[model samples]
Target: MMMTERGMVAPVAGGSVLAQFDDVLAAAAPELVGHVQAVKFDADTGRLGVVPDASAYGTKLRWCARKLVTAANAKVQGANVRTLHVLAPAAGKAGPATAAAALDRQPAAPAGPVRTRETVSDGYCRALAAHREAMPPRLADPAIVQAVERQNRALRELSRQAFPKPDAVEDTPARLQRRRQAAATEAAALRRARAEKAGRQVAASQRLEQTA
Candidate 1:
């Protein structure tokens, strides 16, 4: 036990404050009794520091720290416990930190096998062939395969979104053909609309010229 400047005998190693806090918690909030440990009282600032048994309790204890101080100070006179500071056990420790550092240093697992263009095309072709066979089954079958494989290569080269492989939707022949046809139709419609708009503007200018 040590005597403070206020002429009060302070608890040695926080015995008085810890005892007071334990009694207060036990009477009021019994469930939170063991959540906090290592109680310390600051005579100067009226601040209280507590080390939680585990980090999980730190958040819970912090939320009600002020209430805990009031309860504790009321229970034990002369402690003057005010603001509560919850100290996590692992905050300044090295064991858990070293383990985390080692984990970060460990090499990552190798990625799954990348599907090459030929491999992907063969897989798709095999899946397609399972449904129906193409003419000559060898020569004619390669047309869709080559088209999709070429597109996959081009797409993979263009953007990171196409990384590892192109979208499976682009690999399907009927879907690819439909997408191309839709794009062509939209482009043609846009061209016709622009031409019609330009003709209307020209007609309006000619009418103004005639009026002038």
Candidate 2:
């Protein structure tokens, strides 16, 4: 395979075919663009190798493999890319001798500070809370909200594990109701704040119009 002008790898025989396939793939799955490292096609085997930038992207590519293969075949006429094979990152050329020499030349990396259970729990909870707060208000989708709640619960569990309190009482019906009430109150306050901001912006615009 040879690198095209756009840095994508394509087979020598049908570089243009693969290039068109790449464009089609990008259009079909825009999210997979940067994540895809390269696309290689084998005419004899009728296999298209998709190299992802990371392992996580590889899983995504695999999930959408069938759709991609269909798209590729449609885009590249007579270029039958039947199977999609997600390839791992190419191994480095460094042998044992090379690695040993490099190790001898470079200084050892400093050890990172140890993270205690308390610290881990505190940091995780704080991060999760911040993430929840940072999410856009428009993203009120049930799935997204549930995902965030799951993360919040997981972080709370971790915190409990770090600092187990024997005297801690289980969440009763009244306690759950109170918690829900508090959350509703917080949500109302946030909506009021947003509405006030919008009102102020509108007032400012009207004043500007009057001056003009």
Candidate 3:
């Protein structure tokens, strides 16, 4: 054990108020560095929290993350908690909104044996629902409609890639490599989430966990 800033022998590492938000997402939504960010504690509570990008998909991601946090808190030493926050408006909110609505209308292409209809539909729904709220009135121009549609299509394609055909293993080596890279990137994000969450768990009020 080591002495905490308060002169107490804290049991865990990186448990500071600053640490709680160290991994907080730089932006409110997951538009860039995309995907849901989560925190989990391995040492004590396995306490969990999340920071997801703002959009329809973001909401879905938050829901799924809470479920995991709930399960972990129940089984682990530390209880899980989450904070719902909103970020200031972004410059391109209109773009995301238009694209999402257009994508929601079309079905994504199938990835042969690896992809599932259910997964594709879910992705399409998520893409369509993104940025549904708070779109600027000025973006209603016809020019933006086409551009937004294209962006939405691109987003749908990315979602389609989430599920490979069951036989995607037989696909080209380069394609497989790309997919592998995507998986690795996703793993790094999960690690970041856990680190941030553990920090928050340690700093909660005394009545929360009653740490020594």
Runs of candidate 3 with Cα error greater than 4 angstroms are 1-34, 39-49, 74-76, 79-212
Counting clashing residue pairs in each candidate, in order, gives 0, 0, 16
- Model 3, 1-212: lDDT tens digits are 13444534233331431133322332222242334333322233333333334565455645545444343333333222333222222234323343334334335655686655556666767777775654555648788899999999999888779866686557789989999999999999999999999887777755475654
Q: Model 1 — TM-score against the truth? A: 0.37
Clashes of 2: 0
Instruction: Rate residue 117 of model 3 by lDDT.
Output: 57
TM-score of each: 0.37, 0.35, 0.20
Q: Which candidate model has the greater lDDT, 2 or 3? A: 2
**Candidate 1 Cα outliers beyond 4 Å, as residue runs:** 1-6, 9-14, 90-212
Better of 1 and 3 by lDDT: 1
lDDT of 1 at 72: 75
Candidate 2, residues 116-195, lDDT tens digits: the string is 66566768789999999999787578999899999999999999989989778688999899999999999999999999
Better-scoring candidate (lDDT), 1 or 2 = 2
- Which 10-residue span in candidate 3 carries the lowest summed lDDT? 82-91
Off by over 4 Å in 2: 1-13, 90-212
Error of 2 at 130 (Å): 53
